[model samples]
Target: MTFALGPRAAKAGYGLVAFDQAGSTNAEALASARRGDTRRSWFVTSEQTAGRGRRQRPWIAPRGNLASSVLEVLSVAPAVAATLGFAAGLAIETALRQVSLEAALRSGGRASFALKWPNDVLADGRKIVGMLLEAEQVAGGLAVVAGIGTNVVAAPPDIPTPAVSLADLGVQVTAEDLFSALSDAWVEYFGIWNEGRGFGDIRKLWLERAAGLGQPVAIRSGHAIIEGIFDTIDEQGCMLVRTAEGRLEPITAGDVHFGSVASQGAV
Candidate 1:
């Protein structure tokens, strides 16, 4: 079956390639960028034999899940490019809402459908979507790949965190359908980002849909564990964890847990 984005992708100067199965879409997106294919493009697949989330942990998806990555070419510094993770997450949220996620929310289920910290979309505190940002230097500028995977038809089993899918919520959607919405939503969000000039807006909107805000959470970073209330994400996209001493520590990277029963992972 051939899946593709209609006119929105072409209007945005995007060229796309898809695979029936791949080890990882992020790897393919980066490779396409390195091969002198300059136009903005996306790599997509429905089945992934090997996928990875934060900390190189396994990210498994069924045949109907959406596995996609976009090759973003920007001239900004690495710090600025990193903020695109927020853009990607926001885009996915917007797309899903447009595709009737809001209607699904009213049906009453365990899934609340909200964005999790750093880069994840949670349904009733279980993760429905996750993203990984990968960056490297290409010839004239920086190349970043925002890899996203959504559990549309099926969620992976036996994971550290609780996972949910659209099907589980009684909302029917396919990987191709979600990707079509995502392609357009990504362009809209990218315009809102304005090459990182509009991060303030992104931060405000992201916090509004953020799950676990003002709630206690735990983060595991390197050899240490930090426990605190879920404070607002700062201007630079770092998570602010307000410790018991009332100090707000910035978390730029870590595996965050603490929101539902499936939380509390090993440090």
Candidate 2:
């Protein structure tokens, strides 16, 4: 099936450019922005040849997988734009629930979907979706691109954390169907985000679907490591970890590991 925006997204004036294959949706979106295509738009493809996640980690979406990015230009600081990633996470989580009946049936039962902090979506404790947000100052405003990738047919192998595909969960979902749902869900949550003005509500809702909350966690930030409990995120979306010494430490960025992997410091 070909990709088409949901009714809500179309009505909200979101534009789309669907490609049979692309190097990177995020890179395409940013390049468009630099060329003055600043209107809110989506760049999507099923076969992404070259993509990178946070910390420049390689992420490849083979044929039948979903690689999508949305671009928004606003007169906000990069700090405020960072909070928008929360809305992106929420959108993908909502879309996964909307498209997968098997996932819905498994919810609160066996394998379920949850949002991982910084930018990931987890299914059955394995990574299923990954996200990256990049921004650049353009002529009109700060151009922000939120890239989201979902494992529809296959998952990358030999990763630090195990990855799962929708097929693995008995979810017979197409990338086009999931993208349609995602476009609609993005309209809903991005409205709530309101360019960071409604971040309090986003933070609250994100915690509701957040994985690893109140669980033992370890965050590897560069050469150092911070081990603690996954308490909550702050108003600005910074993760707050309650250490063993009773201090609530704020972490801006890290490679996080939860549950037993944290306790064993295996990550």
Candidate 3:
């Protein structure tokens, strides 16, 4: 059950710094970037004490789960940098399929893994993986950390968003095994991303595996609520929602609700 990089990642010159426990793998990766450790690397752990999700929400990975982040230094604008999350989503979804035989068998079915808009991987419409992208201005370039957390053995209780773990769905996988798969898949998707140049391909693949495409969606952005059909993401990764009036509105950031939750207009 030791954590180690897959052959693909290692062969691609990616470094690894595995932690038994950490406050936040993303924070650790960013700190390393600030310290001029700009080499592309992954900071991963099974237990995270103080992680943050979108809008600064706390996201802790309890024991037996996976809390991992990979640092990439690139010469891309922040707008382009933001699109990397899509690649991260694809990586984890691909990895989940690779590690879990059940996940592979269920692919293209209702209970398969799919990417929820922005930064979540859903299994049977319940979230199993959450991702966060953080960036900082460094000496050489933009340092971006893609943080990925997977519920391996257990999911948090009483969460606003429905959550599920691999074990819960009958796909038993260890954190170490999952990370190995993830590292390999990341190498593939990261190459396709090509520091954002390959985002077009990523976007296309993402839309193909999107969870709520063509469904009613309600996005809570600040104090405004925008309700519409999930149209697609634009070239720059802004979510394009087709409203009732037939106008396509671009959402830069928001909390997306779908299905019954969107019907009720809940956050």
Candidate 4:
């Protein structure tokens, strides 16, 4: 079936495009942007055959989940554009909270969710969502593709750690519902970001929902494993890790292992 944008999508202030299935929403959004589609838009897919993670790892894309990308043209510098990923992450977390709250109003249960530093969402300490943001410089501006995937009904089976789904938490959500919530949340989050907020508000919200703060963590970058105390996120959204030798390291990029201090692993 050919995918079409939802009726309420265009009203959200972005051109919305859909696909029945695709390799990756980010990839499709990038291709669309390269072909002169200038309007801020969203690229969504029901299934992704080759979805990717931050370090090019394969992101699982099961049916009956949320898989989409937001393509935005930014006049901000690369440093600021990079923080857009964190802003997107915050938006996703807010969207999940909205769904969870609605579910709670019906079921009388509390929402038990948290966000991993940078770009992962978790429920009961298991991953339920992942995000990937890609950016490229265009002629007069920058195009950013913010890709997000959430396990609404099914989580991937081959992950290195435990995973969870919204259904598993007794929350019945449709992909369309998630997309709607996400669109609303993104509008709010990006508005804050574009106003020169400089990630201060984003960092605060993320930290409130963040997991593993003040805990021991092992961050792997390439072949090096740096063990430190996960302190807090800095103004730029970098993880602040106080190493064992009294040095506070600002981690710009790495695969973080929560509560792990034994060995270093590939990031």
Candidate 4 global lDDT: 0.80
lDDT per residue, candidate 4, 36-93, as tens digits? 7868898887688899888788886878787989999878777788888877888888
Worst 10 residues of 3 by lDDT: 102-111
Per residue, candidate 3 scores C-alpha lDDT tens digits across 1-267 of 779999999999999999999999999999999999999999999999999898888888998999999999999999889999999999999998777764546552223788998999998889999899999999979999999999998988756689999888787678999999999999999999998899999999999999899999999988999998999999999899999999999999888999788988855
Candidate 2 to native Cα RMSD, angstroms:
2.1
How does each model score on TM-score?
Answer: 0.92, 0.96, 0.95, 0.90
Which of the numbered candidates is closest to the native, going by highest lDDT? 2
RMSD of 3: 2.3
Best by TM-score: 2
Error of 1 at 14 (Å): 1.3
Q: Which scores better on TM-score, 3 or 4? A: 3
The reply for model 2, stretches above 4 Å from the true place, is 102-111
What TM-score does structure 1 among the candidates reach? 0.92
* After superposition, candidate 1 runs with Cα above 4 Å error: 101-111, 259-267
lDDT of 4 at 113: 77
lDDT of 2 by residue, 148-211 (tens): 9999989999677799998887787789999999999999999999989999999999999999
Decoy 4 TM-score against native: 0.90
Model 3 residue runs over 4 Å out of place are 102-111
Candidate 2 colliding pairs? none
